[model samples]
Target: MATVWSVTSPHPVHPLAWLAPHAARRRAAGLRRELRPRAADEPLLDLAGNDYLGLATDPRVIDGAVRAARTWGAGATGSRLVTGTTALHAELEAELAAFTGAEAALVFSSGYAANLGVLTALSGPDALIVSDAANHASLVDACRLSRARVVVVPHDDPDAVDAALAARTEARALVVTESVNSVDGGLAPLHALHGVCRGHGTLLVVDEAHGLGVVGPGGRGLLAEAGLAGADDVVATVTLSKALGSQGGAVLAPAAVVAHLVDTARSFIFDTGLAPASAGAALAALRVLGDEPRRPDAVLRAAAALAAAAGVPAPPSAVVAVVLGEPDVAVAAARRCAERGLRVGCFRPPSVPEGTSRLRLTARATLTEADVALVRGVLAEVLTLVAAP
Candidate 1:
């Protein structure tokens, strides 16, 4: 049986006509994005993911998730402000706050949402946001959504941030930056930036998405390493997906600030709470890290070994990026590595704000010395092939 009910269209349109030009443009520029499926048991050397501590596949983490699902079901059902807050959420929040040395913490669905929640909730037209030029896309989007005056300072330049903050005398000021940049794997001078923010009486919002679990004591993060953790005017956002090797994000600040976010953060109030399984997994991972303090060191060692072998500097965190000046060359080099059974990340514009292209590699604690040697050999061969004659 066939039944149809249709309404008249206002204008005629070709379904594939609009997409053709965009597709052509992408193809010509070698910017087309495609999805590649990975099988559960597929054999490949993994280096592209953000699993710095390699806890994502840990037996304890998996067991935690399984237990949580069996006990709490899969979904949280509604917004946290409504029916979503669970004991697991409360436990995770408490543990994260203590682990990071924050007075309080609030968990969100993802790090992107946590940034959005904090920026949008705290700043408005009357505020001025001074941001690093190389901030993550989430922070950039947060600034845009805040409806505040945004001043983008030079990347990792404390003087630039100070100047921007000083220029905005009449408005409430906020300094936004990433502790460890995702693209080039550069580390921000957090202590210097904090001093500048302190002098200007501005709130320093540090995004430790890449730094957490790979820096500071027992992977406490950049803020703790800089001696800024739990400061009255300092706030930090971290992703549970990376260091924790689970899921979700959190904003850590003073108790009063967290209270304000609980009442005002749109993302936390409207979005469904994080899944119980992820919360459980994150909790377990955190516990494991706390018990086994050398995991972070292992990851950093692996990254350093790979960087040394490649004749490139190791990143401040777990990321080790090998610079390849041209986009096409970087892409080809990454493809060559992949062909040799090694998986790596190819970062090009607009992912890299500096306009330089590179192959971004992440080092995991689970990566063996043999694995590092294999990756180094593969990357060296690929670069040799891609280098100009």
Candidate 2:
């Protein structure tokens, strides 16, 4: 059936007339999204957000943001190259580099921007990019923007990456993968992939968005865990919004690579600097992670508990995915969970493959035994309800 238009414009058709049918298709497929504004003190147990360390509401982190706002105003005002660069941004960059063991770091407005900056600045028509099938959307978009020859290998298949790099015709090459798969919470084979990249003389760029605050010693990320941080041929992009409980992202690499991106990365050169408040919050969060190194372990433990409750394998990071096989079923399960006073993530098509829609439950260091029990009961009932005919 044709979608009816409610437009009253004089023109025969609106320029955006195609949007009606597109939206209709999405609604029919149970793929439409709705925004549910959260109350400041909503009393639901949260397992849906990416606050792996639960530092977003911490007093110290809040203080850091307040101080930054008082000292530097609200927004960055202009691009970093213009009037946006502040002493706080520089300090955060240096601290991030030191903490992650990178030679240097460059901050961007967001993790998406950081990925765009690095990929576009490092690769062009003459370069080949080998990307993992399960990489985050930002990296996928980055590859598209790079204008490079891109080949997507199977998820976590280092041999496929090796073959792709070995057969590439371009003089320059980059292998991009996420340290942890965002959908299934699977850890990538970093060491094996890095070895392949080294053999092929390719640079390895790992997105540590999910790993920085939830994996490795003191949450230094999977690269650091694999002893690959600061390697000459390796680069990493991390989001302060995740484990750091702040906003913005950064690229950590050799000094030369950082310098090149600073000069040529359009995403960084043209975008406004990260807000001073975000820089301060991220810095404070990093310090918290250092002072309380057990936080990451707590995250992993919480993830394990959630996974066990959901009947899934233990996750290596804070993301615990429960595959439910159908979008509607997953949505129903999530709704049931919410009704039972538990909030969990429901991922459907475009986020995960069709027929594999699932619940994406995240872990937080602050989750308690009582919290786990609630999750267990809610999940058990929800799963049973969904499984019934």
Best by lDDT: 2
Candidate 1 on 1-389: residue-level lDDT in tens? Answer: 77453637675455456898999987776677778899888678989989999999999999999999898999888899887899999999999999999999999999999999999999999999999999999999999999999999889999998888878855688999999888877888989998999898899999999988889889998898888889999999999999888899999999998999999999899999999999999999999999988999998899898788677887678888888877777788888888899889988777874447888889899899789889878977887787757
Query: If scored against the real structure, what TM-score would every candidate get?
Result: 0.95, 0.96
Question: In model 1, which regions exceed 4 Å deviation?
Answer: 1-16
Q: How close is candidate 1 to the true structure, as a TM-score?
A: 0.95
> lDDT for model 2, on a 0 to 1 scale?
0.94
lDDT of 1 at 349: 76
Name every residue pair that clashes in candidate 1: none
Candidate number with greatest TM-score? 2
What are the runs in model 2 whose C-alpha is more than 4 Å off?
A: 1-11
